[model samples]
Target: MKEICIVEFTSNLGLKEPQTGKEPGVNRLPDWLWKHNLHKSINPKNIIRVDPPKYSNIKDPETNILNADSLVTYSREQAYLINNLLSANKFPFVLGGDCSILLGVAMALKQKGNYGLFYLDGHTDFMDISLSETGGVGGMAASIVTGNGHEKLTNILNLSPYIKEENLWCIGNREYDDEYENEIRKSSATYISLQELRKQGIANCTKKFLSEIQNKNLDGFWLHIDVDVLNDEIMPCVDSRTPDGLTYDEFNELTSYLFQSQKLSGLEITILDPDLDKTGEYTKDFVNNLTSTFNKHFNN
Candidate 1:
């Protein structure tokens, strides 16, 4: 039986376009999820929440990344917390403030040894600071995790290139800026775009991805899901949105396959903006789908 630990990351400091004036409700996800009976479905006793981190408005002049200093500090702290949970043999369900939290998660996993990454998002997130218009760490998460971004953020915990390029597999990516697309083409990471995902079928494509990971003989792998990957009609509460993403059924199917693989060590859900979910419909749907799917696969 897998022991699950719910870790809430409430820092949006890495976002280039800071949510000012109004409430940045992404940080309140843990509360919203809990209020919506997420704990009841996933076992309330198993849930554990990490204290929210502080955010800063300062941006690094050289790197153009927002809150670079604070980001590094909080990332290490988040990593420490995650590492402790891993040591206790707990499967972490990290609810994120943004994709930048993947940096901290990667840092935690790197301490144990080489691990693969299953990046499931709408955007590739491989943009470097130079090309990134917002300078949000979230945009450069994949690049930072692979040791291809600014030195300070990429070298967190001295684990430069936290995860190897060859070990990373990106799926469900549909939004690719020109520079990001070029970078993806040059990257060693395995990428299966949403278009191709439809062509080959999610199951067959995932099977192939898992085979490659197994061939690499990795210790374990992390799953990163950015909510923007879901269809705009179904999930429209993210910081950024694009048309024609995966349907709820398709996403559920894909996550089910991943959880059943037994190689998944940790998971993070990012980019859901509660401020945009005024009717609470999106949040409710997300909680329902995620909790039901997670319970079906990991419930002991």
Candidate 2:
């Protein structure tokens, strides 16, 4: 059996300041989860921490994305660490600072071979710099990975477009602005809205994603989950709170099914801000649900 290896990277660099004008609290994720015994429950094969670059609110003048230089250097280091971990045949379960960390994961995969992505988030995260109001890399991460943004962020490690559009499946997106033109909708990547998910059923959606990616015959696929994808009522600790999202049961259904697929290479959970959830009630629940699911599926 493949052993689970945990990668903790609590970074807030991908986000913009909220009304507080201070750095968002996404950096506190790894600590918060561990306090709730998330790691204790999993008893992973090994645990490694990928330190993030210092937080900066100023957007990079060069890439027009916040922390551009730091993110590239950070991702390279992260890619090297994860690449080594995966090389040992351990399942790399990356716990993120934010969606921006996906670049490192993509780079690691690119070095090995072609890979697909299963992107689960409340927002599509595929906006261009022109449409982005805050210039946060987390907001436009989908676009960068698919080679949509500046060459600096997209062409890291001399590899442009870490993930092929047709091989990617962007799911559970409920946030969209009718005012701005939708780019992901027009792209080759598969886009599944929450409404569409309800109509089609979660099981069917999961099966379709796995089936389609398998047909592509890629090396494998990675799973990306931003905690905001859960319903706002139960998971309000996230950075960008929206009106509706997958319920805890729905979240379990989708993730458990996806994790069961043998092609699933790694998973990174992002965007849970401990600064928002001081009581730890929300954090405890999230940890319980997520760890239980992981143990149920893989630790069996």
Candidate 3:
């Protein structure tokens, strides 16, 4: 039995206020994600909070630890905490301050040994410091895991490469810079688009993805889902929501199958911008989907 551990990281990362636009009074926004609400929504009463360490602000965007500190320490703490929890037969399900928090989950899981990574997001998040149009560290987590970004992050777990390129599969990515596109081609990673997902069907695509890994005798698989992959009409609480993304049922079905795969080692859910959520519709959907998936596959 895999014990589910939730890490609440409701950080006001970098002190950046929520962006303008978005309906008011929606619980989808970040302001209302209290532990109590999480308890009511997700099963398993044993949840932990991983608060980020304070960091100093710097003028240079790249040098700004205030925002980047969370990204670096996220995996460090996650790795330490989850290793112990997993030893006790628990599976860590990390909730986010942003997608950057995945760096920690990756680090934590790396301790179990090399495994495949299934990244579902709107953007590739493989941009390096030079390629990143936005200096947000969340956009660079993929690059970091692939050993392209900050040495601080890649060096985690003391492994030269935190994540092997062959073990990575990117899904639902629609936007990318020319450099990012080029990197994807050169790298050993595989990917399918949101349009491709809709055309081929999420289950078919996921099955295909699973086929590639089935031969590897994977120790486990990590699932990193960025809410931005959903169309803003349904999940408008993200900083970068796509126009043609998956529907709630579509996402739910996908997660249900994924959990049922029994290969899933851990999960990390990120980039839910509660600031933009209008009527808590996003929260309701998120809670329901999370609840349904756990009950169907993990409640035994």
Question: Which ranges in model 2 have alpha carbons more than 4 Å from their true place?
Answer: 179-181
The lDDT for every candidate, in the order shown, is 0.82, 0.86, 0.68
Query: Candidate 1: which stretches are off by over 4 Å?
Result: 18-23, 51-53
Per-residue alpha-carbon lDDT of candidate 3 for residues 162-213, written as tens digits (9 for 90 to 100): 6788888888887745666676667788867776788988889888777766
The residue-level lDDT of candidate 1 at 219 comes to: 79
Model 1 C-alpha RMSD to native: 1.7
Candidate 3 TM-score to native: 0.86
**Candidate number of the best lDDT:** 2
Clashing residue pairs in all predictions, respectively, total 0, 1, 8
> Between the candidate structures 1 and 3, which one is better when assessed by lDDT?
1
Candidate 3 has its poorest 10 consecutive residues by lDDT at: 21-30
User: How well does model 1 score by local distance difference test?
Assistant: 0.82
Estimate, for each residue in 130-206, the C-alpha lDDT of model 2 and write its tens digit: 98888889988888988888999999988878888787788888876663326887899888888889899999989
What TM-score, to 2 decimals, does candidate 2 have?
A: 0.97
The candidate that wins on TM-score is 2
Error of 2 at 115 (Å): 1.1
